[model samples]
Target: MDIFDTLDDTAIEEEALMYDYLNQSARKEKIVRPRVDHFKEWDSAEFHRRLRLITESVEYLLFLVKDETETKTQRNQYISPMLQLLITLRFSATGKFLCLYL
Candidate 1:
């Protein structure tokens, strides 16, 4: 049997459509005031600062390139690892790609 077969709308009054018009719910309205989020810049700046300090601590940069290797998979060349690291940090910190710009 279909569920609609047992249903009836004849007893439903027009006022039923507007039952909440006169009565307010127990749930209250919440208004959020957004202030200048200074913490965002502080986080990004701090990350950059920390990254710079860490990099500076290392006197020399090291590379692990194979002397005779010449195959494929040059993905790192297209996207700099350092830049991807920064982007990853920002993305991870914000939990969103668009939120970083905001």
Candidate 2:
């Protein structure tokens, strides 16, 4: 088998493990956060603020990973944008993101 096949096998195993963990965790009692009354309204300012925070956090994480990789490689290459696009396309087609660890 080639490297891609090996990687694909590893990803499938990892996802199965993750699914098992999530299923187990779901069985436990969990506290749910209360939703606000305006949650369903698109014009709610609170919802906009929450959305902005989520976007910023995702952006920050992508930046942090790129920064760390650049520090080690010194080649100034990053995979996040391409990865994100691939993920989006995969989800659009398959209804799930493909597990790509690298």
Residues 14-94 of candidate 2: C-alpha lDDT, one tens digit per residue: 989999999998896856554333324434444334343333444465565654433344233333442453344446545
Q: What is the C-alpha lDDT of each candidate?
A: 0.44, 0.50
| Candidate 1 error regions (>4 Å) | 1-11, 22-25, 35-89, 92-102
Model 1 CA lDDT for position 52: 41
Report RMSD for candidate 1: 14.9
Question: Largest lDDT belongs to which candidate?
Answer: 2
In terms of lDDT, model 1 sits at 0.44
lDDT of candidate 1 over 8-78, digit per residue (tens)? 77534445655665555645786645434322434545645434433322212212222223335654344
> Can you give the TM-score per candidate against the true fold?
0.26, 0.21
Query: What lDDT is reached at residue 79 by model 2?
Result: 37
Which pairs clash in model 1? none
TM-score of 1: 0.26
- Best model per TM-score: 1
**Cα deviation of 47 in candidate 1 (Å)?**
5.0
